[model samples]
Target chain A: MVLDLLASGLIYSSIIVLGSIGLSLVYSIANFANFAHGDTMTVGAYAALVTFGAVGGLGGTVLGLPYGFFVALGVGIGMAALVAVVTEKFIYEGMDVGSIGLLITSIGIAFIYRAIIQMGFGADFTRYDIPAMRPIDALVTYGIRVTLQDVAIVASATVLVVGLHLLLQYTDLGRKMRAMADNPDLARVSGIRTDRVKLWTWIIGAGLAGAGGVFLGLFSRLTPRMGFDLLLIIFAAVILGGIGSVYGAMLGGVLIGMTTQLTPILSELGAVLPLVPDTWGIPIGIEYANAIAFVIMVAVLLVRPSGIAGEVV
Target chain B: MSLRAIVDDPNAYWSGLTRAEQGVSGFIAGFVVLLLGGLFTGILAPTYFLFLVGIAGMYSLLSLGLNVQWGYTGLINFSVAAFFGIGAYGTALASASSSPVAGNLAPAVGLFVALVLAAILALLIGIPTLRLRADYLAIASIGLAEVVRIVILNEDQLTNGSAGVRGIPTFFDGWPLLDTFPQTMPSVAVSWLPSGTVVLGQSFWSALLNVVVVVSFIAVSYFVLKRAHRSPWGRVLRTIRSDEDLARALGKNTYRYKMQAFVLGSLIMALAGVFYAHLNLFVSPGDLSPITTFYVWVAVMLGGSGSNRGALFGGFVIVAIREGTRFLNAFEFIPFDVAPLRLLLIGVIIVLLMRFRPEGVLPPQRELIWPSVVDDAPEQPDSGVRDSKAGESND
Candidate 1:
């Protein structure tokens, strides 16, 4: 049972981390919490759902193509890019005038976007209606079953993370991002067009955010407030990992995901030896699971306000 | 008329006024503006206008309370919803102690008590958290608000969990006290009107009673804020907002000031919640949500910063726009489904105002200056000659 929950946590972590990475990136370089990020993830998941419905019939033994996954990615990435571009052009352009103003603007955009989505999607749940998720052997070996979707999610996330590492470390554009983040004014004065760098920042940030959104849909049923569910925790992760550090965001996401489920896991911690309520519960308590990320965020801030990864921004 | 008098000397306008003077000024100004706004609404229907006026007054109270903290002290209080919920739950618990049956419920002395208690809750949360800078505070407060909701949701014994505590009572013509208040204020016969008695409130005047109670509370808040802001204490608070380190170095005890700001701001928020609960006569956990904070934020932000008048003005604008949406919806020019857009508009205003006119629609004059070069400059210094040539990537 413990292993099952742990495996589930890992899968949860992957989906959340993807979404969180964008939030972390946006906060670090853009210099404000992009409150709309949760909606962006929701939109991405919606895009994936649309794609599945539109293209799942393309192939198999009798039905053969199997191209829906790629379709989902395209839709997700495209939706994210749209939000990124529109947000930059319409919302964020004038925001640098004030951080608090920008934050509020993001909130507005989030509400607007979420409302639009609700109008279209009808504030109900959406899913693939696919077969049961098959747990992988690795997850099973850990005494917890990993579903097929989980394996697929982990594999893609790993590749994406690796790809992100290469993009940040090896690419010239990546280096420029690093430069811009380090000091936007300096980078602009030194010859790198900071505007162009920031533009790429949006593209990359939104793209990753979209990618994470797809993972979220795969792990659980999509609902109107799915993004909201993860929003605070993602914010906590971004802050925990150190704002702007993709790696920190990922670390924070995973840590947070684990802790959220950990309380319930602890509730069953070996009968008489259970630490909480005869059930191995969270280090804090139950019901607080929803609030776990926030507590961590506050604690981390008191100790290291700059965040765990030491802020690359 | 008086606003015109103050407008001429806008810079020295608010702070220089004495507390009694400020209180009277604020009250008269508030009554006039609200009366005017409501009169317009009332032209269509008096009942509707009174409702609009009362709601606007309550919302203004909430926003003004927010203004004191965020506007005056530069504290980002995302947990206004939490305090609001706390007060509401306090009211609910107090009134419903007897049972779920509505009329049988006990009187709500606790509602009045909860306003102050809620402030203590705010202080408890704010003391440890407000020490951080803006971004951290934003994150922290969001978390605190969530904690509040979750606590309300889980504390089934107290809050009744998500099912929510319901059937709370209002401060009323209905309360038994109505019978007693008339006895105290009394009807008096004047020499000029020997045939009739000039009375404060008729025996059955619950509306009059509610108005009196609300007005008194508003006056107290106005007085306390006016006194504090004009005092040596107020100067210290404003100074801390501009530069905390400087305030600390000057021995102002910045922590206490922030605590005071948080506590006071939260107390006002709670008071507003209490009034709001009574005005609505129902208390449920849903009454408080994060959106509540942002709404108050809209009020405070749209209202000018560090200026109570601005805060009040901002509150008026937010409530007007929100309530006005319904009027516009009646015109059918815009779909009423666009009710959600009201929030979107607030967000737009928040973003745009922060970017272009952060002082709000009625911000202080000095805030209209060019965006500070020093304010958002790169963290590290750019060696002079280097800035002229071109931009370099920092990493």
Candidate 2:
């Protein structure tokens, strides 16, 4: 039972990390919380769905995975990036507004994005065309069920995280991005092209968000509100990791994922445990899963508004 | 002429006006609301539309509540729906007798309890959150709202779960007229009000009572908030909003002040919820979604965030748009679902307003000029005006 929870928690952590990194990045560079970030995930998922529909015949299994899946992933990433850039240019860039204005604008954009998705998707649950992968019984020997999809998700997420770390540490563009995030005016004074870095920030951040969306769709059903539903969790992760810290976001996501998953288990245990009262055994139930994120966020804000790994306010 | 002048320069126009001029403007605004209500009841002839207006009035109350926080105090409260739900469920649980979990109290007592509960909830939420940045408060409040909603949804024994609590007693249930009017009144007397009036017999008095309750609430809240806005406490709130550090440096217990504002606003929101529950004659988890919070935010923004009158106007505008779309949905010629489109339009409107006219229809008035001061000094160099302008430019 512990293993099962851990396995699911790890999957959830990866998806959350991908989603939150973008949020942190944007928050760092743009100096505003992009409430519409989660919707970008929804857009990515829908993009994948559309791509899969268009390339049904090209989806034959390769290495126990479909080729169409890769195409859909690519398309999803591309579309999310496109949408982010377009919104930044048209909606965000033109306004010389304060953080509050930007924040309100993001809320507006969030509404618009959800409405558009509903308009296109008809507010129904959708699934990708790929056949469901069979769980590998060999991996279940340890009392935890594992599937090929889970393996793929974990492996790809690791690869992506490592790649991101390398890019940030070793690359010139990454250095510029870091500089810009540290201080945009200083970065500009130092001859770094801030606008180019900003554009790249949107591309990469939005791309990762798109990838997270695809993973979310794999783990659960696609709905118009999938991203909206996940928004608070993403915010929790971002804030918990300390805003603008990529590595912190990863750690925050893992912590949040594990806590949310394990809380129900613990609640169940309370019911059966000899020392606990019978009435106390009643599990808090899964409906409170989202509430866990909120509680954590509030607790964190109260205790440490700067977040665990965040710089001093 | 006064309308055009007010429209052209909302702040300066109001500030420059005489006491009589300002009263005229106030009267005109009041007249407009009454006129709209008259149009809904007298001409539209649909009892349903009147209900919509009443609902709009409820939203106006919500906007006013929000204005106290987001507008006057500059606290970004995203838990409007949460407090609203609390009021509703609190009243539902208190007044209900059918539900096993209900307190089975009178509706009036329920309303008082709900208000207290909402105020307490706000105090609890505010104590920890109000000390943080505006964004943190926003996040926390949204979280709190969701938590409340989840609890309401899952606790079937307590809140009837997702099925919702029904058969909630109306506010006018105990009225003597309800007992005597329907049985004693002739059919011709009932029909005398109007053809399509839903307020017939007992319902007529009930509807009248509801209007009286709602309108009185609006009037009382308006006067109270206006008084608060002009008082020293309101000045402190404004100071806290503009710059908390400065307020703190000036020896104000900014935290306590913010908490007070938060609790007061939440209490007002709960009051609206109580009215909403009685009006709808039911309470459900679905009625208290985050979307309703956004609707109020939109209203607050559209009406002018810092202005009480603007909040009221914004509420009416939002309700008109929402209900207007519902009315439009009946038309067979229009293609596609109008519901989503209405939301889309609202979203667009918010974005556009933020971009172009963040100040809203009536830009918030800086200060109520005393007649003596106005005559003595036609143009007082008010620092508040300068600060407000700075705030406006940033948006």
Candidate 3:
């Protein structure tokens, strides 16, 4: 049972990690919490759904997912990036009310994105056109039930994260982005065009979020509110790992995802493990999982305003 | 100008007003006339109109509550809906006949319990988020609000789950005279109406009573805010909003002040919720959605943050947007649902408002210093910078 939870946790964590990195990057570089980030994920999911519908599964399949699905994923990422950049250019570029203003504006943007998507898609849950796959027979014996689709999701997320890491560390644009995120003024003084880098940040950040959205759809189902629903959990992950630190976001996402998936077994853990009191356990049900994450977030804010990886203030 | 001057020489006051003020006054006057005409012509029912007024008043109460926190102290609270829901559920669970937990309580008792719960919830949320950066509060409050919604949604034993609590009596259920006033009122028919006789019945009287209840709530809140906004306490909050470091340097406990404003504002929001429960006569988890929070936010911003008058105007604007979209449903040419259209309008309005007029339509124009203190110190030079920062975003 625990192994099954672990398997599910891994799949959930990959999606969360993909989301957190983008949110953290935007928070650091854009100098405001983008409330629209979640809705951008929705845009990606819906965009991919449309793409997958348009392009039927090309003959061969990889890890239970059709090749066309990967093509759809790429389009989703691109579309999300394009939409975000366009929004930034048209709406956000002219605003001068500081970061706080931007934050409020992002809420408006979030609603707009969701409303448009809802208008088109209708307020209903939907799934990709892919056929459902059962848990692998081999893994079911070990109590580790997961499908090839889950493996594919995790693998794709790893690849994306690695690619981002390489882009941040090895590339010149990455260095510029890092420098800009650290200090916009210093980056500008050092001859980097802050505007261009900001545009790039939106693209990369929104692109990753888009990928996360697609994976999230595959893992569960898609609704207009799906991304908005997942937003707070992603926030917990980012805050836990320390806001603005990409690596920290990854760490936080994994921990939060594991803890969330493991919540159903919390009462059993006390009885299963050797403890002073056999019955001593948190009696909370799985419904309180999100609430638990939020409580942990508030607790983190109380004890350490600066997250685990952030510089102590 | 003094109230006495306006009362003594109303014509002079009217003539002395700027073109913009005159235009706004004229618009309001015209709109009221149109509304009354609609009521008399049978185009709009009096009961529905009264209900709209009650809802407008509720939004005004919410905006006023928010004005205390975001307007005066610059606290970014995104959990307005949570506090509002707490008030609604708190009262509903206590007073609703169908309540599985607690039933058959007087609404006054429910109001008291709701306020206390709201205050406690405010402190719990405020204690942690208040000490952080401004935006952090926005994030944390919203996240915590989701927790509140989830709890309300999942805790079926307590909140009656998603089905919601029904059979809530009106606020005057136990009150003497007022309790039976709506029931005792005779139906009235206006014979002079062009569209024939318009009847006002028990429901109309009930709605009128609700409007009266909400008006009292608004009036009491307005009076208290007017006094508080001009007091030394309000000055300190304004200072904190503009420059917290400066307020701290002057030996003010910024956190305490923020928490006080947060709790007070949350209490007002809860008050709105309490009113909503009795008015709507049902409470559901859906009432706790974040959209309600944002709607109040749009009201505050559009009406002019920190200005009570602005809050009132913003409240009316909200009703217009909300009801106007519903009216859009009457037109069959529109293919999409009005719900998404309303969302789109709200989003567009927020974005545009921030982009073009971040100070809002009716930003607080007066200096925030206590009238008594400033009146006695007339020799002090008015700093333009400080005045400009009155209701605009300081950050």
Candidate 4:
């Protein structure tokens, strides 16, 4: 049972990390939390779902692999990239003239983005069928009975995280981005081609957000409002871990994932208690179980403001 | 860099405000915002006047409370809704338990008790949460707000949770009547304009009565806070807003000052809740959502930070726009089926306004009246300068 929960928890962590890395990146470089990051994820997920429905599932496999997943990933990435550009130009660029100013502007722009999504796409939930996500459960017993899509989420998350780590730490572009993040003025003074780095930062950041959105869609289902809900959780993770630290965000995500996933399952034990679950729901209230992890974020921030890893000055 | 270059830029937007025409335009625009509000009420239902004006008044009270924290103290309070809700509940229960006749433990006493309790609650929450810098405080306060709402909702005994409280007394007694004549439908008001129509199961006159009470409360609050915001105490607050460290260095106990501002602001908000309870005559957990907090923020931002009148003005305008647009379904262009579009429109308008115009339509300038300035005496160096005149005191 422990292994089962952990396995499922790992899948959620992957999704969390994917969405949160962009947030972490934006905070590290942009110096303000992008409250709207989750909305972009929503925007990307919808864009891909709408696009996939238009195409004939990207046709057959290339070299015997399903091309449909890539089609989804490509569409997700493409949409994320487009969204990042538009938001940066219209929303973040002008208002975020100062770092902290960006924070407030992002909140407003988030409302706008959410509004547009609310207006155009409407406020209903949706889902798309991923054909390749089947038959994985047969391979493993005591696997806590996760779905095929759950396994895909885990695999995709691992690839994305590892890929992002490599891309951020080892690549030349990554170094330039980091340099710019460290001191935007100095980066520009040093002729590091800061604009190129910023553009890519948003591209990668939003792409990850998109990937997170896709995984989230897989994890549960799609709704116009899925991003706004997820945004708060993801923000808690980034802030709880440390601003701008990818590894911290991943760790934070896993931790939050476990807390939310495992806590309620443990709440059944509250039922087992002599008088607790039936009378009080004590130790944990299962009805508002969703509010549990966010409370933890607040508690963590109150106790430790710089987060788990202190933010760089 | 020289302080001269930093402090007074010849071509600064603020400098342009020192020009007489701009100042006249500012006052005109301010009046225009109010006129627009009256126009909004006229176009919709006149009964909507109560809702619009009441909401603006309500938002003003909340923003006033926020301004005390953010505008004066440079504190980031993301949980304005929670405090406002507290005020609402606090007042509702107080009024529910009030008796009109007894001078001591009577209706006025109930109000006093609610106001005091609300202040205490603000301190209780603010002490723990406000210790952090702006970002963490923002997060923690937001968290605290959520926690409180969830708890109130969960505690169905004290609060009705999502169902909310009802039948709280308006407490409009004891104050002398402003409209000395017996109330009646106006002799010449537009027809089909809800001027004398039944609304929300309430007679237009009764709703108008509620609006009058709420507006009066707001007006009184505006005067009191406006005075306090300009006083020596208010000066210290402005100092804290501009530079907490500087304020602390200058023999000011910043923490106590912060606590005082927070509590006072919260008290005003609690009163707003009291107003809200009477206005809606019904309260629900729905009214205490995070959205409410942001709406207040939008009001303060849209009006002008630091200026109590501006914040109050913002409160009314934002609420009117929101409520008015939602009520626009009365016209054929919008069917009732698409009324869900209200949230989307509000979100878009707020975003566009904030993004394109962060200073808001009526950005806070100096208190135009000398009396408004006299009490607020620390003498802000060129209040018209840009870059957060309220939040960044460097002296």
Candidate 5:
């Protein structure tokens, strides 16, 4: 049972990691919390959904996902990037208000994005046109019931996250971006074109969020509110890992995801584990999973406001 | 800006107002006239109009609460709905006949309990987040709201679960004459040429009483807020908002002041929720949605962050948007769901309002000196720079 939960947690963590990296990136670079980031994920998911529906499965499958789905995923990433760039250029760039003002504006932008999506695709749950797959026969024998698609999600997320790591550590743009996020004014004084770096940050951040959204849709079903519903958890992960720290966000995502999936077994674990007596258990329902995550977030804020990987205040 | 000035030199007082202030007065005058015209012509049923007024008053109360937090102290509380819901559910559980936890208590008890609940919640959330950056509060508050909602949704025995607590009595339920006042009132009908005869019955009377209650709540809140906004305490809050470092350097406890503002704002929001529970006759987990929080946020921002009167104006505008979109379904030409349409309007308004006038339509004009001091001073300082000299300076 533990192994099965771990496998599912791995899948869930991939999606959260994708989302938190982007949010942390944006927070560090843009210098404002983008409330609209969740809706940006929604936009990516729907865009991919539309693309997948239009381009059939194209007659082949990889890891239980159609080739057309991968095409759709790429399109999703591109569209999310494009939309963020446009929003930055037209709406955010012209505004003179400080970060707080931008934060408020982002809430408005969030509403607009969600409203438009709801208008276009009626507020209903939808899924990509793919056949459902059962747990792999070999994995089920070991109580690790993960499907090929789950493997695919984890693999794709790994590729994207590692690619981001390389780009941030090795490339010139990455160095420039990191320097700009560290201190925009100092980077500007040092002759870096901050605007260009800021734009690239939005592209990469939003692009990763897009990938997360697509994977999330594949993991479950799609709805207008899916991204929004997941936003709080993603935020928890981002904060736990320490906002603006990419590595921290990844660690936070894994821990949060595992906790969420393992919630149902908490009472059982308490009773069975060595540290606890037989009758001592927290008999909480699975529905309180989100609540637990939020509680954990608040606790983290109280215990260590800077987050695990964040610089000490 | 003072009643004495208007009374002493009416013409000078009127002339002294800025064009924007004059425009606002004119707009308000026209709106009141329009509402009255609609009533006489039977375009609006008296009870429905009263209900609309009650809702507007509720929003105004909510906006006022948020103004105290965001306007005065620059704290971004995204848990407005949670506190509002606490006030609602706290009261509903105490008083609702269907409440599985407790039932049939006096509404006054509910009100007191609800406010206390809201205060506690404010502290619980504020203690952790208020000491952090503004954005952290925003994120944490949003999380707090979600947690409250989840608890409400899953705690079936305590809250009646998703089925909701029903059979909530009116606020005057246990009072003597006021308890049965609606049923005791006689029905009246007035004939109007345009729409037909309008009948005012027990429903109308009850709704009228709700309007009265909400209006009084609004009046008391407005008065208190106005006083606080012009006091030395309010000045410290405003100082914290503009420059926390400066305030801290001066030896003020910024965290304590922020906590007070957050708690005060949360209590007011709870009052609004208590009113809503009584007026709507039910309470549900749906009442705690994040959308409600954003709606209040828009109202506060659009009303001019720190301006109480602007918050009031923003309140009525919210009711218009909420109800106005429902009217679109009657037209048959608008081929869209009203929900998304309302959202679109709110989004567009927020974006446009921020883009054109981030300071809002009626930004706070007066300097934050104590009212008595301003009155007692021998010479008046130049108020023009603070009020009318520049548009972006205040922001």
Candidate 6:
């Protein structure tokens, strides 16, 4: 039972970590909470669907393995990046506004994107054309079942995080980006091109958001409102990890993912545990799972507003 | 001024008029719209359209509540719908039968309890969150609202769960006015009206009563808020909004002031919710979605945030747009669903407005004129006038 919980928790955390990285990066550099990041993830999933349709025969299995999934993933990431860049250039960059204005604009952008998705796709759940993979029972001796798709998600997430770390540490562009995030005016004074850094920020942040969306879609069915559903959870993760730290976002995502998955089991166990009465069980069903993120976020803010790794404002 | 001059340059037209002249013009314009809308819908359209107007009045009250928090105090509250839901469910449960799940109280008592509950809820939420930065407060409040909604959705016995509570007693069901006023009245129809003749019936009377109740709510709240806005208390709120640090430096106890504003605004929202519940004669979780909160935000932004009159006007405009689109939806030529399109247009409008005119249609009045010369002390820089001026330029 514990193994099953851990497997599901890991799957959920993989997607959350991907999404939170972008959110935290944007908050750090852009100096505003981008409410539309979740929708951008939805955009990525839809982009993958479009790509799969456009390249039908090419998506067929090769050597008894699905090779087309990789193509779709690349397309999803690129298309999501394009969407983010376009929005930045057209909407965000044109406005010389305050953080509040930016925040409001992000909300407007969220509405526009979600509405467009609804218009184009209708309010129906969709899925990728990729074939479903069977669970590899031989990999584990325990009763817990882990699917090949789950493995893919974990592997891809690990690779992405490592790649991100390498890029931030070893690359000049990454250093410039970090410098700007730390202090934009100082970085500019030190001859860093803040505009170019901002562009890269959107690209990298949105690329990861798109990847997260694709993974989430693989885990479940795709709906127009999927991004909105996951929005608060992503916010909780970003806020928990600290607003500006990528490493914090990763840790926060895993923690939130585990909490959301395990809380119900822990509450159910109250019935069997001798320490408490059977009636001491939590009355709230799993419907409260989404709300757990919010409760944690509020509690965290009250106790420590800067987040675990965030500097005091 | 000539009509052409007024039409050519509205800013100049507004500038040319005295404050009293502007006030009279605004009142006349509002009266004309109400009269025409009432007559047109009462005669031509079904009674349902008038119902929409009454709902608009409720929304206006919500916008006014939001204006006090977001506009006057610059506090971000994404949880208006939660307070609204509380007022609705509280009133419904209080006035309901004494079942195993709920209480049975009088409607008046229910309203009072809802108000108190909303105030207490606001105080609790504000105590923890108000000390944080604006965005943190925004995140926390939105989360708090979601938590409330989840609880309401799951606690079936108490709130009737997703099925919601029905058979809610209307405010006027046993009122003296219902007995005193005749249910039907003969009326002449205009030549342009679809119906050549008209007879106002029971539904019309009920609708009229609701309109009166809602309009009175708006008027009383408006006058009260306006008075508060012009008072020293209002000045302090504005100062807090413009520069919290300055207000704190002056020993204003900014936290306490903010908490008061939050509680007062939430109580007002709860009152609006009571009106909503009684008018609709039902309460449901579906009625208190985040979208409703966003709708109020749109109204507040469109009308002008800091201005009470602007909030009212914004509410009216949103209702007009919503009903107008629904009316348009009957036509067969439109290719796509009108609802999503309307929302998209609203989003675009908001983006454009934020980029171009964040101050809204009615910019907040920078100064209030008094006949007495001694009133000048309140308008000085010590009140954070310079900060507001800088904010305007930034916009």
Those runs of model 2 whose alpha carbons end farther than 4 Å from true positions after fitting are: A57-59, A62-64, A269-283, B1-44, B176-205, B371-395
TM-scores, all candidates, are 0.81, 0.89, 0.94, 0.81, 0.94, 0.89
Query: What is candidate 2's lDDT per residue for B1-395, written digit by digit as tens?
Result: 34676688889977876564476468559856765675545645434444766788899999999999999899999999999999988888888765547565778888888988898889878877888887777888898889989989998878889988887887655557652444465433333444343434545445555666678788889989998988899999988888999999999999899888898899889888998888888888998899899999999988787889888987887877787688787799875656677678778988998998786666575454443564466464655455455446755
Return the lDDT, model 4, position B153: 82
- Computed on alpha carbons, the lDDT of every model, listed in order, comes to 0.72, 0.82, 0.91, 0.71, 0.89, 0.82
Q: Which candidate number would show the highest lDDT if scored against the true structure?
A: 3
- For candidate 1, write residues B70-156 as lDDT tens digits: 877888778888887787666666665432323333445666657766967887788779888786888799898888888777776
- Clashing pairs in model 3, backbone N/Cα/C closer than 3 A: none
Interface RMSD of each: 2.3, 1.1, 1.0, 3.0, 1.3, 1.1
Candidate 4 residue-wise lDDT, A1-313, digit = tens = 5566677778877888888889988887767778778888887787778777776456665422246756876788778878878878876676634554566667766676667666666678777765434434564576566665676677777888898889879999988887887788999899898777888888898998998887788677888778877877787788778876778888888887776666655645654467665544345664454467777787777777657865644
TM-score of 2: 0.89
> 1 or 3: which has the higher DockQ?
3
Number of the top DockQ candidate? 3
> What lDDT is reached at residue A118 by model 2?
83
Residue lDDT tens for model 6, A99-207: 8888888888888988888778877899886667766768466756778778888888899999999999999998998898889999999999999899999999999
Q: Model 2 Cα displacement at A17 (Å)?
A: 1.0
The TM-score obtained by model 6 is 0.89
Candidate 1 segments whose C-alpha is farther than 4 A from its true place: A50-56, A61-66, A128-146, A270-286, A311-313, B1-49, B98-108, B172-212, B324-336, B365-395
By TM-score, the better pick of 1 and 5 is 5
The per-model DockQ list reads: 0.33, 0.64, 0.73, 0.27, 0.66, 0.63
Q: How many Å off is the CA of A86 in candidate 2?
A: 0.9
Name the lDDT value of residue B93 in candidate 3.
90
Can you list the residue pairs that collide in candidate 5?
none
RMSD of each: 10.5, 6.4, 5.3, 8.7, 4.5, 6.4
Q: In every candidate, how many clashes are there?
A: 32, 1, 0, 10, 0, 0
Model 1: DockQ against the native? 0.33
Worst 10 residues of 6 chain A by lDDT: A57-66
Chain A vs native chain A, TM-score per candidate: 0.89, 0.93, 0.98, 0.86, 0.97, 0.93
